[model samples]
Target: MSPLKSYLDLYKHLPQTNCKKCGMAACLAFAAAAMRGQKLLSACPDLAPQVREELARELGQAADPQEELTRAMAPLKARVAAVDLAAKAGQLGCTHNGKRLVLKCLGKDFTVDPDGSLASQCHVNAWLAEPMLNYVSLGQGKDPLGRWKLLRELPGGEDWHRLFGQRCEKPLQKVIDEHRDLMEWVIDIFGAQAVEEEGSAELRVVLWPLPKLPLLIRYWPPEDGMESTLNLCFDATATDNLPIESIYTLGVGLVTMLEKIALTHDT
Candidate 1:
């Protein structure tokens, strides 16, 4: 078999579900990341058999995303060992239990041990674990400023805005556009709150995906021959509490959750 020539070549062989199962917003996003060596072909759980065969032929089988997450956790876990969870409890909006810090994550309780290992009743994903680890190890612990800003406006976010939009906002807009009651599900299930921005009546929801990292989502229904649109924003001080990458991870995770809900509704 010939070597993979480009991202499009990689994309053409994907399952094409845009399932977001590999922690990317779309299959194309996964293909792009894989092409860049930031992701693995094995990350997609639904890779077609022929695609997997081609990869094993040329690339000799790659570690899956879970294995990659486990590898990524090592350094972050080591850093947590040096942190005093008790001292950081207040700033990080967590409760310390001598060796572990307990905090609410996506409306559920998650605990971080001294070694940065995470535990919760809810099923954990790398999308959640990476951000939670960064929050514990490197977070500056700044409180939300209430003012909102695009990811591009954040200090390290300019380079990530486009990918963030593609991965988070656009997928969410599609879900909401197709399933209107998904908003009620967000409000009732995830405890998202409806918020009116300034003086406008635009439909918006505020959710705490992490304690100090709140997210704002606004959706505009289709009107006057225009397509429906959605926008996602972070608190002005968002990067103060989590790295820009972590912020992006949090949004991707949120989209994954919404997609699950939408799938459930469909079935």
Candidate 2:
């Protein structure tokens, strides 16, 4: 069987229902995953049996997330190569270094080479690199309006909210509940700003993962039989600065980082 060419090709075969049953926000997301071998076409129960069988035979097997991420990066990198980094520096709040565009990420300098390669004083991963490249290449670079909204409120974000809560907020809340000091440590280490909000949340901080994309994390400690809770909110213009998928990746990435830090401190 021949391999699928692109996500769009796979998308054409989907039910286009935007159902969340497959753990993805939409059929398009599932299609992308299917094409990358991260998910099987049969995962979508809505798919016709014959269609599922045909796709299963064609796709061969599902690749792990890391393998899928690596494959997805190639086209994104090519798009980045066509971008004029210098021209976008001002809009993106980056510095044009003649040969690269440098931007501050999580308080660390991340330099993007003209060829779309990334270098940072801190560790780099596909999760971070993919979003950064998307921001540099496709971001409208609109400034945050200081208005905050939940992930579901952003354009095309409704379908993704549940998965975001499951993969990002819930896990981070567990870490914060276990290590309360981790919040302050993240603020100090990542150059995040502590903010006051009228709520039960014991701690709140805003992290600028991208110049125009600010994420606010609020943690409410358990009290009076209530369990601890955490919620991640974003600027209303966040979708303009990064796609919904990239935003989800960013949240998951941040949570993963915090989990590592908490583990290290515990040891």
Candidate 3:
């Protein structure tokens, strides 16, 4: 048992600004990371000097967060088992081949067995599995509207925007900054389609993470005293296809995959 019993214990104390001052995309992310022992409480510059110091003293004593993740996922996994995957496949714009329901994620095939276990030819990343199960079990399965909006603009996205930027957009910007030339190749590998935007984006691409879920990215290289930028946006119907938390997880997972792709090719 740790002094910080749960992430909310610390979340309640913060400014809730979602400011990136702590190097985390959002205040909520920082608190959760701190609870997981991945970050220090003192890392948040916004916290009172005394408060941060006090919390920092208790941070190192936190319990294992892996158990918490497991506890959180258990019910979602159980829900998958109760779902008639084959019967619901069509609604999800996926396929059923008797034994498994096959869903396409970021142009990759991930098959779900009747027991809620997932298998993919590609590695099943920890960030992606939970969301996949969640989508299959509870997603609204609506078709995307093709109209794009920021994570902050989507339903329930206000709370998640900063974290989404931290986990997805900022990392994508980092990749573009370091490996500018290789981006075309990376996007190509993911079958991303080049597109245009009004803001003079040097590169804009669209990708379909799911049949009803589309992601759009726009990048602007450094110029005229402005830093480089990358923005990851989603369809207006994003929440209809996946929950806000799952959407954030999926974005993080995509960024992780992009980093891997860039690394593998740059070498």
Candidate 4:
């Protein structure tokens, strides 16, 4: 059997009922997990026997998470090799240093070579590399409109909103709750700016993860028996500069970085 080439292919075989029986909130999420080899086809009890057998044959063998990420990033890297870095720099409001395209990522200068190889003082990993490549290859170079909106408000964002919250906002909120100085550290380390917005939030900080992709994070401290809340918003033109998946990836990446920093400080 041929291996499944994409998540959508795996998703089509699922029940699509958005039933949480598989431990994933939606069938789409389950499919994504399966593609990443984090979940097995048989884990979805609702799957028909025939479909399970077919998927088992087509999926070949489950790969480790690192291997899955490498496999998924292969195509994006190939595409990056085909793009002219200097040309993309102009289109994406980046600077080219003759050998690489430089863009501001989380206020740090990130450089990408023509072969999709990335370099920065910050950590580099498949998660960040994939999105950076996508931005260079597909981003439309739209200027941020300054109007902030929730991720769900972006085109095609509704389906991803739940996962985004679980993977990005909730985890980041936990980090902040545990480390009282986290918000201030992010502002200082990432060059984030504290912005005053008309809201009940006790703190609001704006960060530029990409040149045109600015993220606004708001934190509402616990009050009146209510738990604290953290929300992430982006410029309305975010999707125009990077696809929704890249946006989600960037958010998760940022949180992961902060989590590591917090851990180091705790140690």
Superior candidate under lDDT, 2 versus 3: 2
Query: How do the residues 139-165 of candidate 2 rate in per-residue lDDT, one tens digit apiece?
Result: 998999989999999998887888888
How many clashes (backbone atoms < 3 Å, residues ≥3 apart in a chain or on different chains) does model 1 have? 0
Residue pairs with backbone atoms closer than 3 Å in model 4 (clashes): none
Cα lDDT of model 3 by residue, 1-267, tens digit: 236789998888788987665546688988897787656565566788667666756664323345535554566778899999989999999999999999987778889988888899888886788778888998888988788899999988887787778778999999988888776785666677888766665788888777678888888899899999889889998898788878888888888988988888767
For candidate 1, lDDT tens digit of each residue in 1-267? 558788887787788987665767688988887776566676687986676767745544444546656655677788888899889888898898777899897688889887778999888877778788888888888988899998989988876778788889999999998999878877887777888768774788999888888998988989899998889999998988888877888888889888888999988
Give residue 39's lDDT in candidate 3 (0 to 100).
61
The runs of at least 3 residues in candidate 3 whose Cα sits more than 4 Å from the true structure, single-residue gaps closed, are 1-72, 196-201
* TM-scores for candidates 1 onward, in order: 0.77, 0.80, 0.74, 0.78
Q: Candidate 3: lDDT over CA atoms? A: 0.80
Model 2: colliding residue pairs: 37-63
The total number of steric clashes, by the backbone 3 Å criterion, in model 4 comes to: 0
lDDT by residue (tens digit), candidate 4, 1-267: 456899898888788988554446688988888887666676677888777877866876333446545555667777889998887788888999999899888778999878777789867855577678888888999988989999999987886788789888999899888997877878887889998767655788999877778899888888899999999999999998888867887887888888888999788
- Give the range of the ten consecutive residues with the poorest summed lDDT in model 1: 56-65
* TM-score of candidate 1 versus the correct structure, residues matched by position: 0.77
- TM-score winner between candidates 1 and 4: 4
Clashes of each: 0, 1, 0, 0
Q: Which residues of candidate 4, in runs, are more than 4 Å off?
A: 1-67, 197-201
The best candidate by lDDT is: 2
Better model by lDDT: candidate 3 vs candidate 4: 4
Order candidates by TM-score, high to low: 2, 4, 1, 3
Residue 131 shift from truth in candidate 2, angstroms: 0.9
What are the lDDT scores of the predictions, listed in order?
0.81, 0.83, 0.80, 0.81
